[model samples]
Target: MTTRAGLITSVTLLLFVALVAASALAQTNDSVAAACDAKVKAPDYSLPEWPEKAEVKVFIVAADFNPEQIAAILTPLRNWSAVAEATGSQVTFVYSGPTAEHQDCLNCLTIMRGKVHDNQKHAAELQATVNQGEQTILYARLVIDRVIPNLTALTNAVAHELGHNFGLRDCFECRAGTTVMGLIRSSDGLTGPTRCDVAQVRRVYDHVRIYSAEVKRRKPQQVAKIVPVDEGEEPVDDDTPIVVKKP
Candidate 1:
């Protein structure tokens, strides 16, 4: 998320952020940076890109704690997917509970790397929202004692992190006025992408563009195929809850 770290000392500017925390639902190990700092590598096209007409399927991984609650949260994701699809992008939500076959198990960006150990604590970031181009993938496993009481809280956390999985930079509400890719701070953490984050997924999907599916193995892949921004589609306002349905 775009957080203005402590700005230079100035008499007028008394507020300056020291360190903005990232979102907890993002890639635990992979997401560490915001935008590409080095260079923008041209996407290698081997397989065909996502067809505008075809729908993109995504696999979701949910916690075993509460199946019913998980389903409820997914409904909003489905609706949000429609928003992206209508903008030349499509998404198909896949549940990854009980069976996390392909999805690398959602990871937590907030989790520290050195804090690795076995303690029935599921320390390994086993939950994250994976995205391939326009295809957005989410693995919802965050639960207290296996079940969550506040559905609204669950939706807010997961959906915000999913936004990062789609490659949109996370930022504070202050940045929303300037860039579409603004950082959103939540009770989870800051939102940023690391080397193994968006770029890696983008590479794999981009490869599919040049080469046909003949060589590509049809194992269980995440999401795929996202078209450019369509005209007249305004970005969702920051305050709009991603997972809650309006009454």
Candidate 2:
């Protein structure tokens, strides 16, 4: 039988251990900020040659959210700059107070179509097809809300959702593991969709395919070591932090 004082000491020790673990996880989450060389060496991602110029607009409905929350939501927006440059496109960000007038003039398209979306207008206009449908848009909402686990998960959600609008459907293996589209549904254990997603802007603009035939040709090459399972080692997951690219 443990004494009361002894029990309290054990509890305190457990709490301290838990806090230490949480701190370590927080550091891991900020891995991108620590990168010094990621942008420099990637063969695929350089200053993407603009076939013409891409016009990407981000309309964030942030009225209901606190400014601090909005800032957190925008934290991943920097990745958009990288994505845009890779695609040879220009990006426009639309958010609270500053873009109030533009909301009235905004084009009606999907923002997100979840039960609780960051923005309502985008939800109302979201349209999905039989092949690549509702779930794609829903995943983006989860990313915006930061309901997913990591930066990889969030970035995957955005990339997947944007894929749906373009007419690309979920990839085959994406239904199981850590794909940009698969992570959301697989993590939740849901049925897979039938169709694929495609890019809408390609009709009028020079499209840089994201995870498609073109981007497939341009996908990031593994500069770091990749041990195959046959070599008595497990293959590295893309999300694994292997080589710290020092910028």
Candidate 3:
């Protein structure tokens, strides 16, 4: 008994409701993806020892970043070092802000200030040159934008960028709350690395074993003590007198 116009209106309203429902469902899926607890696979390789004998060095460009921001960045790095402490691996991170002359040097991490891919949306980035077979990080650059001016944002940016140095890769799946390496979500506090991140870093740096130069070189002593031995080739006692056998 409904008129044609009424039927058309009813159909349009139903379509509108369906579209709204679809949009809502998509948002829900996106949120669930972001919150998915997943960890990135750890690197199977290791970085070579630094020529200068440093385990790790983090240098930030002397920009207008404040003390809080710097401290926030250092927190995760120190946590990362703690994982290597079991092997007596000394991981050192210095703020060498602008004073680091060897930013391009091997095994060094340089934090720079610039636009993130010329995109205003991104706050920071991490780039590196890793070697093959050895998987050594010859050099790394951490680009961040101080213009954001948010301390928490900057700190989180630093953590995310440094995560790359520890072998954290971009999320291949819905690996959000599992670690800082995952896709950042509203649920993320952006404070520090999660257990998954620390475990991965440990796996990477645990290969470093501390050894002394003398032990590594296996060099013989310059001087040798003279000892008298038997003519038959048997070793003589310390008190045994040397028997001079002259032909």
Candidate 4:
């Protein structure tokens, strides 16, 4: 009992709905692609610092970083650590000097701040690999320099470098309010990681699983333990030895 015109109208409505659904799906895929351009792959090489151990050891390799500068570096780290913990991916940092002990530490983040190399114009550089054959990173080292020496710039640089260390890529053009993973300095003037930044941390680390056999083979010794502290506590004193705080 249906007319030909009625059949055509019904077909048109169905096509419209299908088109809307396809468009929505495409947008979702694009959003995922934009956020994680370089997703964290399965680790061919594992480190003791990552996964369930939940600790990241930091060694200050450069003599240039005074206590104030060190504290500035720690601020964003502390914030990010808290963000990771909120998502059930626990992480804390143990600050250390460039002693022989640090040389033997397997998965520490060795930080050096000084003049950038001739070929490097960026404010910072992060290197972590073994002979470039193995794609997995066992350790991450950060070298920071003054491409634009301002407080906000340097702080944001540290935050951005830390994001790379945490296995995130530059999602500069992603539709977010602000992020530390921008390719260039953001005019938003944010000196720390934003909500978008923390969300990335959660995405990467929250469901991380440790491979037991890999940990057994690498067996890195714990450099220090973390002590719980209030989030609003003052920065550590200049002359005091570096300490690890619970996230």
Q: Pick the candidate with the highest TM-score.
A: 4
lDDT of 2 by residue, 78-175 (tens): 44433443323344233333232223222222232133232211111123211121111111112133233343433344444443333332332332
C-alpha lDDT of residue 39 in model 1 = 30
lDDT tens readout by residue for model 4, 1-247: 9999999999998789667656654553444345443442221122212444457778875565667777767776676676665434566656765533224245567777655443133456665533222223355666676554555555666676666655555444533235666643424354555655555555444323322344356645433333111111111112222222213
- Candidate 3, residue 51: CA error in Å? 10
lDDT of each: 0.32, 0.31, 0.49, 0.50
- Tell me the TM-score of each prediction against the true structure: 0.33, 0.33, 0.53, 0.56
lDDT of 3 by residue, 142-186 (tens): 766545445555555566556665544544242445766544332
Q: Quote model 1's TM-score.
A: 0.33
Ranking by lDDT: 4, 3, 1, 2
lDDT of 2 at 85: 34
Q: In candidate 1, what are the lDDT values of residues 155-229, reduced to their tens digit?
A: 443444444334333233323323222322223222222333344334433333323244444455555322221
Each prediction's RMSD over C-alphas, in Å, is 19.3, 22.6, 29.2, 15.5
Residue 93 lDDT (model 3)? 59
| Candidate order (TM-score) | 4, 3, 1, 2
Clashing pairs in 4: none
List where candidate 2 sits over 4 angstroms from the true fold.
1-54, 89-156, 165-167, 175-179, 185-247
